[model samples]
Target: MSGRLRLSLQYKLFLAFVLIIIVPISVVTYVTTKRVSRQFQDHNRDLIRSIMEQMVRAYQRYGTSAVAKMEKASHSREIQEISARLSLTDSLGTTSIFEALTPEQITESAKQVGGPLDLDVFTILTGDGTIISSSHYPERFGYKNAKLLSIAARQEGVPFLIQEETANDTILTVQAIQRIALDSATKSLIIAGGYRLLRQDFLELILSYGKASLLFYDIPKKAITRLPPGRDGNPTPFAQSPDLLKLARQISEWPNNPLQPDSGAAARPELQAEISLGNSTYMFTGIPLIGVDGAGLGVLLIGLSQADLYRLLRKMTMSSTIAAAIGILSALLLSILFALRVTRPVKELSRAVRSVALGNLDQTIGVTSHDEIGMLGAAFNKMALDLKDNREKLIQIERVAAWREMARRLAHELKNPLFPIQVSVETMIKAEQRTSTEFSTIFAEGTQTILEEVESLKSIIKEFSEFARMPKPVFGPTSVNQVVKQTLLLFNPQLRTIRLIMDLDDHLPLIMADKDQLGRLIKNLVSNALEAMGEQGSLTVKTHLGSPKVPVGAGGTSSLASEGAAERASGRGIEELPALARETWVTLQIGDTGEGLSEEAKQRLFTPYYTTKPKGTGLGLAIVQSIVADHNGKISVDSAVGQGTTFEIELPISQPSLAGTETV
Candidate 1:
């Protein structure tokens, strides 16, 4: 298992993916939940604080209008008419002017000053409290001991906020109470009105921060408010958890220490904080209300439940998850495609190797890619090519080995009988052994024929033996022009009949070549040329140094230069040897206007034992090819049956040297 584990890139890649993204995501989830959520909560609280200040300013403005209306109505036309009709004595105080004008009349008159509302709008002075109006159903009119209202009436800059309660029952209402002067009277009246709980403006302030709901409560005063209760409109109560209630109470009493609590102090709650009310959780935040004299009046509360917070969180979470999934899937598909792209060259190399294993040495896998894997693929392709080349060399070597075996057999088979024939012919050539001049002539002919046959056998042995054991090249600098000249000079005895034309470049650079083998190469080409010419044609010997100047076709040589360094080194695996071959080449083209060879003959001309002539040993051009190849050169033939032949040989020209000893 461990060994298999060691070889997998997939496991390594997975580890990389985890390291790069998953671990970081874990960290982010922790920090965002721990640190960022609370910060968001703080931000929301600041917003609430700002809203509280705005509310204070708005209420202050509203208070001015309410106060002004009450003052003006005291001195208005209706009140003066009522006063005249009553005919009360001057300076009479504490008069009950109720029978003349009802509550409806007061509401009508109040509407003329402000906007319209409930019809039960009237003012009454009780023993210790005063009532301006009641939106609720209540009848206690003449006297009610209400020190809450009385204390708020005298000496105030802003209105006082107080909780409203029924005489015998606990009424959950918050009241905004204030004292106002009627017609500059030295005595003042306290006015109050409110509904049963937190107003619309405060609920709206809590709902604006994201989708969270906040609920606040007072532990001491036990004051609480829940907004937007549920889908159906109903108020939800605060939950039974002490910690939550405590936090809510703390929030409600903000800007004041609830335990000791500063005077005229208030505190607002943070946004995104959740509070449970009833069975459901609500989110909200609130602060304590302060009086105009910097005194702590009571705790102010606000917030909603938890259902909506989860809904918003799920929405955002789903969107981000889908986006992340799409990104990962795209990466997955791309990774598969890229892996295939990376592995294609390797697949080709594998196929090529299989082909080679099956003995098909001719298959080639082309180069691809530029990265490390691509480089490796290129190297594998090179190995395949080398394998193919070595296979071909082995086949060639085998063929040469088989030819040697055949030669050994043939030489052995004919040796004994040919020796007897020579002995008999030579004995007959002696005068005593001959019966007449005719016998002598016949004897001479027989001996000559036998000697010629023996010489042919010797030539056959020599050719195959030389081919079988081609000598290692002794590399040195040599001039190709001189080699060509010497080869032609070796045929100098026959130079009399053949029209020999020599054209050679003077400055052909020295090339690394085998001296004796190169000389033999030129000799064989000249011999083939002479043979093709028979006894009477022009033999043009041309020598030069250049790119593929050899009369062999330019097909393979040009590919060497164009295919670039690597292919040029291998010479494009061309069948015919290239003149310049692996480096600089000296070109020798020997043309003979003789009985030219056919296309078929040209193809097989350099092949060992493949001959067109009846008496020809067939090793002439074959040896030429072998020697030229041995020197890292090439040999080829071009011919027309009647037009004669051209033997093109390219040898790596080295320093010029004298010819070897002639075997006469």
Candidate 2:
């Protein structure tokens, strides 16, 4: 069998507990982790969308404020005066305008208007897109500002953002243009006012709503710039990172551009993605920045750090694992305790059963509860009680039956002798009445017959007396081989007609027994073997130092001999035999090749006065059993009709000290 199948009940119960407790816990943890992860992602997505929307609204508010300021600056008195002068008509009665003042005077007027309105660029332009005067860029006073003029042609006094190239760098500006007509022929002068869009100001405005970093993707240049939230460092680090550049390109292609004018009818959801930068991760969303003319200016990326969320998830998983471990351990402990609690009674009951099997009918178990185990304990106790009671009654009945059998046999034996004597005396009386000679002859023959019958009766009575008064063994060290040899010496004369076989073990250990009784036991067994073999048979005697090959049980004559031995050894049961006593036993066997006994005869062979031979007094074998039993040994007969019989005896090598024994 596999090791798993061989596991004891306790381990099996522990595994059951693990499956019942830990499996569900693991499953629940897995499911809950998945649910929580999904929720966190959904919540993060919603939060990022909210932040993006707020950022867009803030940008819109700033733009609206800048446009309002530019509009206010346009209607200023200084700008109006500059526009009036720049729009002076020529004397040719045409719509063409002229510069009515010196360039220095026009520049001074642009500065006076721009300085108070906080404008970054204030310029006066001709109808043909030439800058007449400039506040922020005086060097470009006469330059043809083609980009501004193109926007001016399209503008209707509404403010819009545009990128302007200065001598040093490109800058984004929010500008508004207003026209000043000189005549009816469409010749006009323009006044343009705007504020510069600085990177630091843009980032500051974005950071006002949340703690997130920003990245700007300039669509035209195909470049990505990192806009840190702080105001001190270089706000725009135009580092050309390939990974960031790739992300920016991907964002630019997203269809949901929030700044698209046509996107108002559809949902302008932010395009979101995850990216790892250095050792940290970020969740980024893209919001496109489109100009008023529907031209793509750039994409603005807002990123939120995801390190805290990851840490939280890790903590949750660890906590669940710890809890599950504790639960499994607790379940295992409980299972062990429960298994012990459940199996303890069964173990006790099993031991009690073994004790009862060994002839100890007084065994019992404790019943502590009303559960099934407790009920089993109660049942075992009841069974033991019943067995003990039944055994006592059986022993009483057996004693009664034994006495009745002995009485009947005694009566039968006495009747046979008495009948012969009675007939002999009656014949003597009849001869006495006939004649002196005949009477004398009859008297002599009758007296001899009567004497012979009386002698037979005396022998029968003597045998019965010896069986009834068997003596306690005086235990001492005596060699079993020596006793067997000595006993066989008495049968040497009868061995002449029979083949004598002696297989005595020279190494047989000395046993503690009464020498006289031990010799008598061997003698009786040998004598019976000789008589069974008749005139032409074999007689075998063997001695060994071990238990019988086949186990002898209580159902055989061996068990009866053990019971008798136990009764003689202080009225103790067979179970009371010490372990050492049983281990050191010596075995002796005597066999004869004669007409073996039948099964029925073998069973009753040890019963007193139960003999099979026509003229045999069964007390011979009965006395043999009694002597062996007195020495606390066992005897059995292996026999079958026509096959011969063998009597085996087992005696302890060294008997334990009893109450009155001098040597043990």
TM per candidate: 0.40, 0.54
Please provide, for model 1 over 1-664, each residue's C-alpha lDDT reduced to its tens digit, 9 standing for 90 to 100.
Answer: 1233353343344445545554455455556554654554565566556555654554454445444444454455654444443333232132443543456643343334223322112233322354422333234443453654454556333333444444443333333334444443444444443333344554565456445454445444565544555544444665456655566555544454322223343343432346555656655555554443344444444443445445555654565566556646655655456556654555556555534432344455555557776677667657767875775787689778867756665566467558867676666766446466577667777777777777777776676677668776788777777777776778988778889888988977877777688888778777777776677789998877653422334432211111111222232233233333424556677888887766666556656667787765566766666566455455556667788777666553432122221110
Backbone clash pairs for candidate 2 read: none
RMSD, model 2, all Cα superposed?
A: 9.6
Model 1 residue runs over 4 Å out of place are: 1-470, 493-507, 535-587, 593-595, 639-644, 650-664
List where candidate 2 sits over 4 angstroms from the true fold.
1-3, 9-43, 89-112, 120-124, 131-147, 158-161, 172-174, 191-202, 229-247, 260-262, 265-270, 314-318, 321-363, 368-376, 383-664
For this target, which candidate reaches the highest TM-score against the unseen true structure? Answer: 2
TM-score of 1: 0.40
Cα displacement (angstroms), candidate 1, residue 546, comes to 5.3
Return the lDDT, model 2, position 352. 63
Kindly provide the TM-score of model 2 when superposed on the true structure, using C-alpha atoms: 0.54
Model 2, 271: alpha-carbon shift in Å?
3.1
